[model samples]
Target: MRDLLGDQVLDLLLERSKDGKGGLRLTGEGSMLGELVKSVLERALEAELSSHLGYGKHDPAGHGTGNSRNGKIGKTVQTGVGPVRLAVPRDRAGTFEPVLVPKRAGRISGGLDDMIISLYAHGMSVRDIQHHLRQIYEVELSHEAISNITDAVLEEVRAWQARPLEAIYPVVFLDAIVVKVRDNHSVQAKPAYLAVGIDTDGEKHVLGIWLAKTPLDHATAGESSRFWSAVMTDLKNRGVRDILIACTDGLAGFEDAIHHAFPHTTVQTCVVHLIRNALRPVARRDRAAVAAELKKIYTAPSAEAAFDALADFTASDWGAKYPQAGRVFEAAWDRFTPFFAFSPAVRKLLYTTNGIESLNYQLRKVTKARGHFPGDDAVVKLLWLAIINIEDKRARERAAHKEKTGKIKNSPSTARLIEGQRTIGWREALIELDIAYPGRIR
Candidate 1:
């Protein structure tokens, strides 16, 4: 090669390539660089083995040692430059473990696994990923191979779910979104419940997700209650010692579950859901009018005044025309009005499950592309990916904003956004809570 280069063969080769075959190709399997990489890797492995044995290959020092060099084991290792055949060094003692490429590793490089996870997290289907690999890298990965790669995240998901949580979340929004999953040999829609907690600093955090399943011999309603109970128990077990208030969409038996799990926690029904339920039985034309009246009740100065507004509405023309709408409001009046006891700032946070609903929207965007997941773990896996992606984006945006603004001199950190929200009327609410249920806050 040096003789040819000295004879100006390098210039001729470059000219021929520029004429037709395109520019230089420096890497990939079977290329000159690929052979060099393989040679270098094998040499490194031999060096590692030499270090482990305290002697070089064919060294006289190895003669008396209990452990000595054994014959090379030639193995085909999958690498970024495609598959390369490597002569892995072995020792008679069999105690040497290669750190560069472990014995069980089929792939010599980590790049492929990282790429597979990135594509899967972005909502690409297994088939789409197979085609992507073929087009981009001339690599054909089987459906089973892609599935195995994504399934590796299950252990991570379990560990994340079981990780410890904050001792106190001032507010938590609980809600469920439906995703289609294959169950009992058929695809069917099932509810996946999630909890989003707002720490005292006010930033939103996803607490966890649970797939709703009715245990055998238990009714749907009973199992639903138990499922929530289990969720609450999981939170407690994970170090969530106190939740000041829980905002929910008012799923039946859920309030009781909250009370059962955390005796002193306040349960506030989402006013948005309450309004939608209130409008369901009303005439289409009366919706605007009734919604206005309902808003008066929820936005009232106090619970007593809110009940007064409800009474006045029931006696009014619109409420009289849609009695069932008023009846629905009357049914869960206490849960519906818990926000009234809170200050306006707290009321804004607790009056709805919009925070968790927004997260569900993001989750749905990722899952909506698939008709149905093969299993529950698949659904959980995708949702976890979506959350990670969304959080990553928000973190980047926050960082950029902080850099541009320089400490937010006139404003606040995203933390302040949460603190300002949950802290408004917080002092009064805490005082009331502590007085009402002594030792709960402590």
Candidate 2:
């Protein structure tokens, strides 16, 4: 490459790259690296134009070919290191199309869009991104340009949201997290509902994400029957014909909503939610004892045994003192006891919605940095990007762990609902599910 540029040009580049203090400047504004990149791209565009015209410059192969070089067009493009200006070659016929830096493209390919999206996914606001690029890459981008770049993924998000789903998901978890969005000229909290499904192959997948239009006004406002029904209907329309078990965080009317879409899907209230709700009213100091007492009901060997344990707890001192705690379990007992019908392995998988909760936790970390979003689209866009970022990060961690340990870690915490990563203990769980719901496994 240095030989191709000749010794004089290479020496000039090296000399230009040297800082006044005797160090080298490889990046940032006015760096020789940017100039070198500019030269390489301009040369590549010229080559492409030559290929398009079927001749080299001033070759004189045919003087009367009726097509010739016109002049160079100046264009500026954003790059990872910085922005570079290029002299794009044009033709007399206006037929040349340069593939290296296509006409009207403000940013070059090769991961600039991806980098911006990744940064946005990790919770960097548009202004933050602008500052980061200006400070680190010495590239100045307008707010509108940065927004347009990130907004390009809205189409992808729509396509993904409308994509067909599996016919049969052995288990599906429904949950929602609240996010602040601008509405009615003020910021209001809204629910972002997510559906995660586990297919018959034991692989996990996030079915879709929906941002409810109704702003949350109270604790239960985010979990509504109408919104959840729409979500369930969406899954059904997208090809989810059967779900053997639907786990939820004990949202009001959630059971009826699931039944409305998939009547055969057994609604199992999330044990963790039940426990948390039960412990919420208990004194913090007594929570440990209350939780310990509550565990006996869930861990009981059978539904009848669980009921007996519940009765015993209600008669105990902790249950009498915190009667609401016992009522929390009693209210959810119908949905809660479904897990007792399955084997212990299956029960472990069906009893909780931890996978979706973990995903929500990650999404919150991304959204928490921003006090509020401008609109629903902005919220959806950021959350979608964050989900992609999270799954990618998890995938990298899994790959790294496998490389170092020569074994994949099948831990519950790593059991994400995307990328087809199998949930821990799913194989054993599936066998029990097959027995529990004979024809549903298919």
Candidate 3:
């Protein structure tokens, strides 16, 4: 029955409702879908967050030093689903600390308000959801109640902006999507920058989030260089030493910053961005052939081969109509060539930004109904809650993969030194120990 209602519904329930003899019941208000979710989720969030603060497992989203001392308090992140919280077993204790599995911000993790707002962003009208709640769970949901949900994320968003991060990542991908915001004066929709990273193991993690200037003109206060610099500094302090690769759509001076911070890393402009950027300059009649030719270049056996293919395809097909397309490829030709050195396995991973793209895709799915986030904290609250979903997905995948392979890797062994550490008088472990290391035994 839990799986039947799905994660989204279950998450809402975990946040706002409590388990009862009669099935799902609201924890606070009259039982109904929206109100119930708002209540139960908020209640569970408070409980979980209280545990974190008491035991010091982590800080709430809005607080910051860019770093902090972690404790052993394990708690669940009650989602709309049931309590989707992680109780880090006490036995494992301090030995196994998870960075990404736990949401980094405290305030974001403090409540369920943003989770409700994200639902609104995802396309559920406030009244529609209110009506749905009344009909299903029989709870009343007011517009202001919904606003309260979104308003919760603002503090978290602010802290997330200043939170410290690891110094090096194997690969980092940067991109953005539009989100609405209300500043001191007026309310307007703005672009929200999304930065995501892939660790050596391939699990994707969120670095932080930022809001862009609205009005659709790329030149506004939305994409500030200072914010990007602070993010870089935080990563450095967190012990990130080498960034092997960076994937981005296209940001002015972002490349320069990457080079200044980590000179050894390779930067690859997203092919999706390149193709989209190049197409704007091509003729409609010739766009199909041009697109096909560009695809061939990226798909070629080697970067040299890709260049050759680009020249030939352009000459016969697009010709003078799309000369700039060829030049665009030329400018980015060096980092693009690494694919030629990769086997099919490595190439598939390097060529696309699918790992990072998934984050934005999830954001769109999660926030479809919300026209604007009340402030930054609202964004962090919803996103921090969503991180739990990502961790759960990763855990399931890792468990399934381990089960399929029958054996685990990287186990430690004491057999090699056991004999040396013991002295045997008879046919005992000490005898083997003596035989293994004759002079070393006492």
- Per-residue lDDT over 220-306 for candidate 2, one digit per residue giving the tens place of the 0 to 100 score: 235668877887788889998998888887776677788888888888899999999999998889989889999999999999999
> How do the residues 328-387 of candidate 3 rate in per-residue lDDT, one tens digit apiece?
777777656755655454555556675556656766776666776666566656655555
- Candidate 1 is scored at a TM of 0.76
**Model 3 TM-score (2 dp):** 0.56
TM-score of each: 0.76, 0.90, 0.56
| lDDT ranking, best first | 2, 1, 3
CA lDDT, every prediction?
A: 0.75, 0.84, 0.57
| CA shift of 366, model 3, Å | 2.7
Question: In lDDT terms, how accurate is model 2?
Answer: 0.84
* Per-residue lDDT over 327-387 for candidate 1, one digit per residue giving the tens place of the 0 to 100 score: 8889888888777766686677677887678778777777777888888788888888777
Tell me the deviation in Å of residue 57 in model 2: 1.9
